[model samples]
Every structure is written in C-alpha cells, then in structure tokens.
Target: MLIEQSPSLPTVAVVGLGKIGLTLAAVFANNGYRVFGADINKGVVKTINQGKSHIRNEPGLDHLILTAQTNKTLSATTSTSEAVARADIIVVIVPVLVDDQNNIDYQFIDGAVQNIANGLKKGSLVIFETTLPPGDTKNRFGRRIEEISGLRLGRDFHLAYSPERVYSNRILQDLKNYPKVVGGLDKRSLELASNFYKQAIGCELIEVSSLETAEFSKVAECVYRDVNIALANELAQFAEKKDVNMSEVIVASNSQPYSHLHSPGIGVGGHCIPIYPYFFINKGLNQGLTPLSRKINDNMAEYAISKIERGIESFVDKNILILGLSYRENVKEPTKSTALLLIEQLRNKKANLFVNDPQFTESEITKYGVKPISLNDKAVSTIDVVILQAFHQEYSKIDFSQFSNCKFVLDGRNKLNKDEISQLGIKYEGIGL
Candidate 1:
C-alpha cells in the first residue's frame, strides 16, 4: 500500500542536484516528505529554489518542481550541513565518474559522504543511490562515514546501498513504479532501509544479502547491455563487408522467441553503458570479454568514419552536415557522446562539418568547433553528405526532398528509409542496413 503523508514523515536530504538527484528530490517532495536538495553548483540550487528545472528535456520535471515549491515541500541549499541537519534521512546521489584512463573516480562520492558525515545524526538512515563498483559501498564509503562521524554501524545509525535504476527521460514514472533493490550492512540496517523505501517511495523493496551484491547488480545491468550492443556492432561490421542488410536480418532473427539482439549504431554514448564495463574490468574480473567490449564500443565512431570514407572519395572540401549532436534522442545530456568523437576525427581530416540539434543551443553547438545549421537551412540542400547521428523527434518530420543537391545520406542510426531515399536519387546508407 502507498504510504500517505503525515506530520511524522521523515525529512529527506538529497545531495547533488544533478539529473538523478533533482528528480529524486521531486519524487520525495511529491510523496509528502519535506525535501532539501544540496548541490555544489549555485546556479542549480537557485534554479530549483525558483521552482524551475535546470535539467532540460525531462518531461514534467518543471511542473513537479513548481508543485513541490508551491506546497512548501521542497527547497535547496549549498551548505551540506544545513541540508542534512533537520533531516532524518540523508540520501547520497552524487555521480561516480570514469576518468580518461577508465579508472573510477570517487572524488564526487567521497566528498558527498564526508559532507553527510559532518551532519550525521543518531538514528538517521543513510542510503547511497550512486553507482559503485563491487565492495565500494561497504569498504570505502561505509568506512569513511564511520571514521568521520565516529558512529557505529547499525547501532548509532544505519547505512544501505540502493542504486537508482531510472533512465533520464523516465525518472518519475520509474521511481514510483519500478522495484527498488536495497542492501545494508546488517539485518537491522537492511530492515530500516527497506521499510523506509516501502513507505517513502511506495515501490516494491527488494532486499539483497550484502551491500556489494546491490552495487554489483547495478553495474551488471549496464554491462549486459554494453556486451550485447558490442555483439550487434560486430555483426553489423561483418554484414557491411558482405553487403548484407543486417537490420533486416535482425528483424527476422528476433522473430524467434529465444533471439533478442540490440540494434547497431555509430557508437555507444551516454553515462551508463559506456562507463559500467570498466567497473567489472577494474576489479580484475571478466578480464578479457569486458575490456574487449569496451574497446569495440569505443571504436565504433572510427568504424562510422570508415563508412563515410568508403562512401566518399575524399574528405577535402566536402560539405558534411551531422544531424543530432546530443548523445540520444530528446535528452539534452551529452556526456561521453560518440558524436563528439566523430566530429574530432572529421576535423582532423579537414572536412567541413556542420551540426544541427534542436535540443542544443547555437553556442553549445559552436563549442564543438563546427558551424551550427538549421535542419531546413538552404546550406543543408547544398551539402555533399548528411550524417544522421541521433534520432531526435524533430528529425522524423524533416522533408528529405529539401536536400536537393546532397549526394549521400549516411544514417549513423537506422532512422532513414533506404528505398525511399534511394528513389529520391540520394545514396542512403545506415549502420546495419
């Protein structure tokens, strides 16, 4: 049963007002708990306090924030002490970034735990929603909290690891509807964390035996997708050499009940799939396959460039327009975007590159050192090649006939209709088909 709001509902302090953190804050506030959001960025804090969303393209986030603000259930602050002092539950939702060398950087989570430790109170429950490698939550985070706060685990306070499983665009619905996996240091801690989530978020609470198991489950979810995507990419490459339509093959193959293959793209992007395989490899487990998948996905941009190279005789003086700069469709986040890597490779070859994404501002597109053009601009008609990178919703409505003089349309994603574009006298090629 969903827990109804009472005067006794525990206050929630969510640190780090990033995509996940801000959404979670809104979730708790809408559920009738007082939520205090803490972030290092003053602008983000200000935006949340003003009942506006700093994150873009998230459906219904702004309205949720406004409702929370209007009801006096949500507020934000930069001071970690102020955010957690009056709260009975402190939730750490900071990011765990992967460095250039593929090593897990714990700086963000470390700083968050230290701040939470500073305001640690007796009888309060501390739950970590950040993704971590196996043993990180127990050995590193829990140890640090105990050291800094001088609190005994499961005695003075409780600790748990519950990874956030929601995607960027579907956070609110997922948080309320999805099953929440939680694990703790001991039985008492587990019970406390599980009961709180059951009443708080009103989602089905799944309990694991150890904190490490909970952490590993989250990493494994991403690794599974990454490995499957790598398989699809490998098959796509082989199909290209044989002049086979891989997308058609995939469609036929998926008709079998046991067959479930992911679609091939120019490259894997976003925060999770590109980053999570490293957590397994770094821990000295699944040494070969994990690293190999990461390498394959990472080099997919080069594979895409190879396709462009094969289609065109030369890159010199070629007018190439890349459609969609953001990592994915509709979402504005570009973290570890493969399009950025493709742009860098194209620039090295002295190709004239132009980008267009409805979600990105002109200045944002220019930061990539490429000219920003509209989808309907006259320059698009004169382009020699059009690379459809991301499948943004706006691109679906584009009139392909407008590109009157374009010679090639390299669909980085399988978004364009091959027969239709071919009939229009434009050479159409996609990643798999």
Candidate 2:
C-alpha cells in the first residue's frame, strides 16, 4: 500500500505489450523513465528484455531498447503481478474488438483490469488508453477495480481514460504531433495521468470533463474518417457507372480549396474506422442515429472482392495473388484487417489464393493453415489476377516485366498511375479509376 518515489523518474508499468504498448514503452524508456512492460506472450517479454523487437514499426525501437537495457531502466516480464506491484503508474492498451453481429467484445480489457485489481497498490495511478465504449472505463473498470482492491478513488488510487490517437505507420511521428486527450473520474486523476503523457509524448494534453467525453472523442474521430471515406466509396461507384475516373474527379474537386476528399480503396481496413462507427450507431440508436457511414464502409469490402472475382470469370481454376496483407502500408499489424475478410470470401469460391507480403514471413502465414507465395519468386508465373491490396513501397517498385505473365491487375489502393499502366499492355482496373 506504500508508494515509492524514485530519484530519477517515476516507475511505470505498461500492460499488454502489443503494437501500441511496446511502442509507448520504448518511447517512455527513451525519455529516461523506468518502464516495466508485461505481456502474456513470453516471446515478447524475452525480445524486449534482450533488447530486440517483437514487432516492426518504429525506426528507433532497437536503439531505444538498447538504451533501456544499458541504463537498466526498462524490462519486461510474463508475470502481471510483478509488473503491477512494482510501478507507481500503470497504462493499459488492449484491443476491444467487434464481431460480425455488431457486438463489442471486452474479454481482453476485462481480464487486464482484473489483473490490475489483484496487484494495484495505494497512491498508484491507473490509466486506460485503449478505446472503448463511452462510460465503460469509468463505470465498469473503475468500479470493479475499486471493489477488488478495496481502494477508494481519489483517496487510495486514481483512474483515468486517455485514448490513443496514434496512426499505424507513423506512430513515432504522431506521438509528437497528435494531441493527447484525457478524462478521469476526478480532478486529481486527470492531472496525474495527463502529466505522465505530456512528459513522454511532448505534445499538448487536452482534458475533458469526464471519462465518457474522452471515449466519445476517440470514437468520434474514427467515425468522422469512416463517414468521409464512405462518401468517397459511394462516389467512386457512381463515377464508374458514368465512365469517369474517380481519382481525377477527386483531384479536380480539391482545386476548389474548400473540398477535401479521401481516396477510395478496396475497403476501409484497420481496427479503428471499421469498428468505431458501430459503437456510435448502436449506442445512439434511440437518439435517431442512422449509421450510413458503417453501412458504406462495410459494403466496400464485398464490392472490391466481387470485382476481383468478376475480373477472372474466364479462368476455370484461378491463381490469384494478393499484394499486401497488412491493413496499411509500412506497418506490421493486421488486426481486424479487411484483407482477411477478402481472403476468406475468396476461399469460399474455391479459388486458388496466393498471398504475398514483405512484412510477414512464411511461418506466420502457415500458422493460419495457409501458405502464401513469395513475391520475389520468378516461378510464380501465369497468375490469372493480381490484387494490389496494400500500397507497400516494395509493391510500388515492382518491375512490370515480372508480372507480364499475369492477365489482369485489380488496383484496390489505386496506387498505380493510370496513363503509365495503359502503356504496359496489361488490363488494369482500380476502385474508382
């Protein structure tokens, strides 16, 4: 029940060593804070403690890990108790996913809260940085933690919600650029947690009145992107019917200087945009919330998959290559990614699927009971169709000579230049153009 004040920096424990958690740990460690990261995965713990990286995203993860190791200021463990008991501040970043039925799943977050309750000490601050349904962190996690630990809020312990606004590929850059939003159960809770993030991120820390406001802000940001993307998706479909290039149309519209249009793609992927719209739609149903945004984004996936299928109708047994598997380019996370949905839909049609991603290895793909072909393999000849799912840099630099044997190309990302592809003598089609 005692809190220790270290001379160097406050000791912090970051629970759930996923993409966000590990990145935050390294950032904090780089800033001279003593950090202990805990994860259920033993391999992740070993990699961090041994000064190696488990995931690839940030450029200086290895350098940060080495710094943490040399200073003996950062370590990781498989034991959640050891992590919680040793720290004065705890940050939680876990996934809260949605099912096909539009139900929110909180098994991961709930289990993490239970662990925090078991080991949380008096005078320690606990911040929930994961995006969740509005008021769930304040009413659900706060109440449960208090009951189990017998610690009163604002007296013995503190709890707050600080939703992370980090982009997938630009985590390090956004850490300094994006403002941190925090809301808490009480005033003291807000100050304690906001100060911690302000120090590590070195950005503006915005405080809202309550925890639900912070949660709503996070969901609202993603929903805004979803709605705008859906507008582009809908416009793309109409533009195709009119025989107009959607990309050129959007570019022309932007000349007005008042119009900002998002690009259309195979579909909206990633954990945020695809999932957050439902949280708002379902929760605000009685308030007359019509989720036109969620409907459009969800349908775009099926539409793109259907285009791929229709493009190869002449081929009996098809060999299809998906260019990228990760949600977006330059990131390793594939959580709730649209590529899996597209892959599953293609499998149901009994088509031969060949997957290729530079980020993932053959062993990782084998874990899913499916092996993807290497993009570098010259033997991968005579592909019936190729879907450019992710616009990775490697895919951009690919020589047209290698894909000469391919019959058609479906540009889901609209990554290729329209005029240049027509000169290549291959049939190329994109989402809008």
Candidate 3:
C-alpha cells in the first residue's frame, strides 16, 4: 500500500543529484517527506530549486520537482554541512567506478564519506546505495563514519548498505517493481534502514546479516548477467561460423522452460554489466580466488571488437555509418560502451566514421572527434558500411533504401529484419544470424 499520510517521515539528505540520486530524492519527496538534495554542481542544484530538470532521462521528474518546490518539501544545497545538519536519514548514491587495471577506485566514495562524516549528527542514519565489493560497508563506511564523527554505531548513529536497482530510463517503474536488498552494521541499523524505505516505496526490503553480504549480493547479480551475456556472445559467433540462426535455436531451447538464454549483441555495454565483474575478479585475485567471470567478460569485449573488425574488412574503402553511439538504446550514458571501443579501433584503421544518435546532438557526437551524420541527411545513402550499434526507435524508423549505396549492413544488435534488408538487395551481417 502506498503510504499517503506520513507526517512523521524522516528528513532525508540526498547527496549526489545524478540520475540515480535525483530519482530517489523525488520518490521520497513525492511521498510526503522533507528531502534536501546536495551536489557539487551548483547549476544542477539551482535548476532543481527552480522546479526544472538537469537530466532528461528520468521520467516525471520535473513534475516531482515542481511539487517539491511548491510544497517547500524539497530544497537544494551545495554545502554538505547544511544538507546534513537537520536530516534524520542520509543517502549516498554516487558512483564507485573501477580503474583501467580493474582495481576498485574508492576516491569518489571516500570523498562522499568525508563530507557526510564531517556533518553527521548523533542518531543520523547513513545509507550507502552505491555498489561496492564486499567488506566495504563494515570496513570503510561503518568504521570511517563512526570514527570520524565520534559516534557509536547502532547507538549514536547507524549505517547500512542498500544497493540501488533502478535501470536507466525506467527508474520510476523499477523502483516499485523490484524488491530491495538491505544490510547494515548491526541489527539496529538494519531495522532503521528498513523502516525508512518501507514508508516511501512499496517494495519488500530483504534484510541480510551484514553490510558486506548486501554489497556482494548486488555485485553478484550484475556479474551473473555479464557472464551470461558473454556466453551468449560466444554462442553467437559459433552460430555464425556454422551458418545456423542462434536466435531460433535459443527460442527452440527455451521451449523446454528450463533453458533460458539472453539475446546476443555486438557487445555488452552499460555502466553496471561491464564494470561490476571487474570488481569481483580484481578482489578475488588479491585474495587468491578464481576470476572465471572476469575472464569471460573481458574477453567478450575483445570478441565483439573482432567481429566489427571482420565486418569492416568485408568491405573496401568503407565509410562506416554507426547507427547508435550511446552505450545503450534510450540512454545518454555511454560510459564503458562498446561503440567507443569500436570507434577507437576503426580510427586506428583510418576508416572514415559517421555517428548519429537521437538522444545526443551534433555537439555531443563531435566531442568524440568523429563526423556527425543524421539519419535524415542524404549522406546516409552514401556510406559503404552501416553498423546498427544501437537499436534506437528513431534509427529503426529510417528506410534502409536511404542506404542504397551501402555495400554491407552490419546489424550488431540483430535489429534489422533479415528479409527486409535482403529484399532491398543489401548484404546484411547480424550477430547470431
């Protein structure tokens, strides 16, 4: 049941106004809680205070902000101290990214902890929503916050790890649909954290024994997808070699109800899937554990890159037109996206590249130093190679006839229907087809 009458809801200090942060803040504020958002970016804070949105991907966010501004239930601040001064609950939703060597770089999380610790008051509940390797909560968040604030855990203050599960472009829906997993330093911390989320969202909160377990659970879920996708990609390659349709084979196998297989794509892209497996692998190597998952995911990128290289080689003097540049369809976040890697490989080969995406503008695409080409532009017809890097709805609408001059269509996403492209007299190469 949605709690519409929470006059005693706790005051929330949401530090980090990014995509995940803003969605969380809006959800709490909309449910009759006093929410304060803090971010280093003053412009984003100002935009929110004015009932405007800084990020476009979050749905119904502007309305939430407008209501917050009108009701005076939500406010923005640049001062961490000011943000945390009166809050009963503090939520940290910042990114804990991995380095090139697959090491967990905790600099971002460390800075956030310092800011929160410096301003924490006794009895404040700190919730770490960022996904990290196990042992981060008790060793890093719990110890650091309590020690720095001179507070006692489970008494003077509380700490918990509840991983964020919202998917980009579908955060609002997923937040309610997905069951939340939470773990804390102690039982008291877990109870407090569970009660807090219980008021705002209708999802079940499964409390675990320790914060480390909670952190590991989130990473494990992501790594599972990474490894499975890697397997699917490998099978896609094998199918291509055997001239068998992998998609049909998957469908036939799935008929048994026990065999479930994911779709095969050119490469895996997304902030979570590509990055989380590395944390498991790197930490295991440090402690002497098997890095089977990491090896598969790392090789997946290389394998997908090889396919693109082979596709490029099939055509001479190829002027490749990349259909999608953003990491995934309908999202503007391209971090760790395979298209960037493919672009780098192509640039080294000196292949002329033209990139276009509906979510980003010419200025955004040009930041990569590649020439920006639009699907509506006549140049779409003149390319020698067209790779469907992203299956954006906008790109799917474009008539393949526009690419009449193209020699080959590399459907990395298996996006184009084979009969449609084949009837157009264009040679098509799709992964797993």
lDDT of every model, 2 decimals = 0.86, 0.80, 0.80
TM-score, each model?
A: 0.95, 0.92, 0.93
Model 3 backbone overlap count: 0
- Residue-by-residue lDDT tens digits, candidate 1, 1-433: 0112236656889898998899889888888688888998999988888888998767888898999888878889888867876788889999898988888888878888888888888888888999889898878988888899898777888889999999888888898788999999899889988987877689988899999999999999999888888999999989988989899989999999999899999888888999878888888965676788888988988887787788787888888888888888888877888888888888888899999989889999999899999976787777888888888988887788888888888888898777788988988888877
lDDT score of model 2?
0.80
Q: For model 2, what is the error of residue 345's alpha carbon versus the real structure, in angstroms, after optimal superposition?
A: 2.1
Worst 10 residues of 2 by lDDT: 1-10
Superposed model 3: Cα runs more than 4 Å off: 1-9, 285-317
Candidate 3 C-alpha lDDT tens digits along 1-433: 0112236756899888898898888889888688888888889888888877788877887788788777777788887667886688999987888877767788877887888888899889999898888888778787888888888878898889999988988888899989899998888888989988998776888888889889999988987786677677778888989999998988998899887788888777777987877667777643322255445544554565466566456423568888788878888878877778778877776778889888888999999878999778888878877778788888667788888787677787887887888788877778788
> On residues 1-433, what C-alpha lDDT tens digit does candidate 2 reach at each position?
1123246787888998887898898888778578888898988888888888777766766787788776777789877767898889999997888877878878888888888888899999999989888988868898898998899877899989999898765677788888899998899999988888888778888899999999989988887788788889899999988999999998899999889899988877788888877776667642322377677776776897677666667434677778778888867667666778777877777767777888889877655544588867874666667778888888777765576677778888998765565567667889887
Please list the Cα RMSD from the true structure of every candidate, rounded to 1 decimal place.
3.1, 2.8, 3.5
